[model samples]
Target chain A: MNPATHRHPASYRDPAGFVFEEDGILYRQIHPRYQPSYEQLKQSGLYDRLVSEKLLIPHEEISQPNTADAFRIIRPQRIRPVIPPFCWTYNMLLDAAIATLRIQTIALQHGMILKDAHPSNIQFIGASPILIDTLSFETWIKTKPWIAYRQYCESFLLPLVIGHHGVPDSPKLLRAWPGGIPLETGRTMLPLRSKLSLHWLLHLHLHARQSRQGDTPKSSSTGFSSGQMKNLIHSLKLGTTRCHAGNKHSGWTNYEQQVSARGQYTSHKLAVIQKESAALSGIDTILDLGSNTGNYSNALRNISEKIIQLESDPQTANALYEKNKTAGDQNSLSLCLNVEDLLPAGCDHGLIPSLKSDLVLCLGLLHHLTYRNYIPLPDVLNLLAQLTNKYLWIEYIDPTDPLIREHFNPERVEQRLIDLETFEKQLETLFTTRYHTQLADSSRRLYLCSKK
Target chain B: MIHLLYLDPGNGSYLAQVIIASILGVVFYFRNLLYVVRDFFYRLLGKKDRSADS
Candidate 1:
């Protein structure tokens, strides 16, 4: 078996097809059993409608099948910086549930239904959540219950309900139950107040009880009108929307408002960063470390096409996600992550999309890693250098800056270099400075450098 | 649905949704009936007619 071509780890559950990557490009191979359904998907006009509406990721037909068991192969339009479902904020997950139901609604109208409904089937591109799996649809048999009903409830409704009840780290629970939260476990975890609502009672509480009893619809009528299925899905959508994250804590979400008060300093810093970034060419991919509400990333819109904003604080990341979503800014991807975790030794870079950026912006984040995390400065620079392909735009903050004083102690800060002499000496070893400028009224400074 | 093909849709969820959806089907049936009645009255009174529930 050549190592260059291998099946995606998570694609084993479904027998219809599996995802594989060859030389870092992803493709899906449809098994011979699913050939009929794949034909119907296109011949019925469902594929075209879904693609045009942006509800599904569009794929191109590759005439050559890669394996003996495969009947067809397709290359989907890949979305970058693949984020794990466990890390999604309350609203991100909620929007995913709605998008899933919306796709099923459209599918039902086209004489088909989703054979599987799970968060794993969805991927967010910019602010929009799109279904990536093309093999999930099957003919909608009138007598058949939405065979994926149980899967949908467990996958979407249960998680949303758990988050709604303010369970601590509910999103993290997805890591344990990636195959959709176990209905029994989720039912037990839900609060008593949840039973008060009709939709919850029917979908979760009552559903779990029946499952426990092992009740099968032996002689009972299993057929309901398509209208009823649509009605049920509509109810799920309404219920899912009501489930809120409700656990936003900390001041980082409001960091931008506080920084705006120091307008003289911020304006100057942004101006220099923008001007320096504009001077550099061929910067298609950009990464911003500690992007509090993505102010700096948003300012660099004209310079780069794709911006990856990494923010550790969940509330602040959600705020940025919400802001970008509302503005319909499809060019930016905001990921909730700790900066220290990304650019360090033995860090599991497997879960995130590859971070081989052309230009990396490390503004105002170096001091925090050095002072709070106790990491050496040279190692941080080395990690940043490895992450970017060409240029690095890093900032150096002195102990006197008010922003640094908020959470860090200036008097005991011995790990960071206070003087430019040591700072430049440490920096010049890896990158040659292209331009350097000091903010108009502050001791903070920005540096634009390229790999030597 | 459970006896059908490769995917396992949980038995309890299938059973529960059957009962709820059947009840909903009845509710929509009556809703459409009411709409028909209302529309008939509107036509009789020379008022704007309404469409049946879909």
Candidate 2:
């Protein structure tokens, strides 16, 4: 509703095109520099084919007759709910990676390639991954090796191998190196035995060596002919097919094997909230923030009509989606999303975004915001309060909690920590704290609040 | 294992299994309660989570 508060970085990648929102509808404005590529994308019929097939988001070309600065602008068909990679379950991420590859192969056929390869560029729409960046296409370079290879590896390959293969902390690997993980860094993380295999050897080992060769004929004369292009597509299709839901690690199956509530702490905390939530009548939907596998969603099954669990971990979200989808619980939907960049759908403009939920749960999620630049905790509470018209069930992890400290680095107990009073002051202004309970040790607290 | 491995090669084969499983996972993601019950038993019996292994 507030313009200053709503503006998102128009996907900060290229220095050229910029994304802007007008009346809640998102439109991308391309400068004169990218005119050639934009022309090629439309004239080549790639735009029509992709949009019709639903591989790419559909956009409308806007031309105003009276304006002097007639810049080429496109308004893409917006997604109802925009989710981030962190919120995806493992399978969802895999699907996204596959979709990106498929899009890349299709672009190559049209003499174009994706200039950037950030996972955030892709999002899930109804169990299928959709490439959201309509501007990623550019005229292909026949002589050069795929320039976006390293990024693909980092944004797509690294997370997949690390999450499904043995590395449980693969997601952290990307978090540490926002720019695609360096090849050498990836090589170091992989076990010595993996280097002997061809896929790892050529892609990871030799690829890193080639990168260091700096300007050593980065482009080869080799180009994919019509037949060879088909083969490449087939190869990518095969690669995506191999990457599937069951490809989880032992740790993933028993994710809490290393971490539990250290006694009956989790159960106690959850039970308290359940008792309070069950008492509320005429409530239909409950949004479970940071729902780590739908455990909390189970608690409100009695009184709540539908429980939507939002998780940041791609793998966890995928697993939760699969679990809930299987039970045919139409009332329950799990989506991967980042709470930091919360946007309300259905703006004043033509942007038909997803409808905002009634209730919101921010359990065990606020601490992660500390890692980024100062996201004033009050601002976050304010945003949550703004989006919801009903009750809010929230949780705060005690500063003394070891897991909280470990997950968040530098252990800035001073700059980041939000005491009970500070947090209460932020929320009490917008809503009154109706019920509060200390879950498990003194680390976890659950509060049920009503709108003022 | 014999039926799957013999039909495909390279990473392509991995995807073939994955696509099959994905379709099945979507179809079965909500319908059959018996699958989860069976999977729970497998998990208890030390059957590794091979859902993504394809």
**Taking the tens digit of each residue's C-alpha lDDT, what string does model 2 give over A1-452?**
22223334534345446566778797676666787888899999878777776678888877632323224777778764564454456666666777778788778878887776667777655565677777778888653334455566656676666555555335445445545566667767766765554344444555566556533231334332334333334443454455444444333345555547377876676778778777776776677766776777666778876676766555576677777756756566666555654633311112112424567777766776653434777677776676566888888766777776675655465677778777778878888888987775656778888878
Q: Which CAPRI category fits model 2? A: incorrect
Stretches of model 2 off by over 4 angstroms after superposition: A1-16, A65-70, A80-83, A109-111, A141-144, A217-286, A290-308, A311-316, A324-358, A362-390, A394-430, A433-448, B1-54
Clashes of each: 0, 32
DockQ, per model, reads: 0.24, 0.02
lDDT against true structure, model 1: 0.77
Model 2 chain B: weakest 10-residue lDDT segment is: B1-10
| Model 1 bad stretches (over 4 Å) | A1-6, A64-67, A166-170, A214-227, A245-250, A343-348, A409-422, B1-12, B20-54
Candidate 2 per-residue lDDT, tens place, B1-54, comes to 000000000111222222223333443445457667777888899987555364
Residues A107-201 of candidate 1 have per-residue lDDT tens digits of: 98899999888776787888889888899899987666777888888878898898788752465577677667888888988889999877787
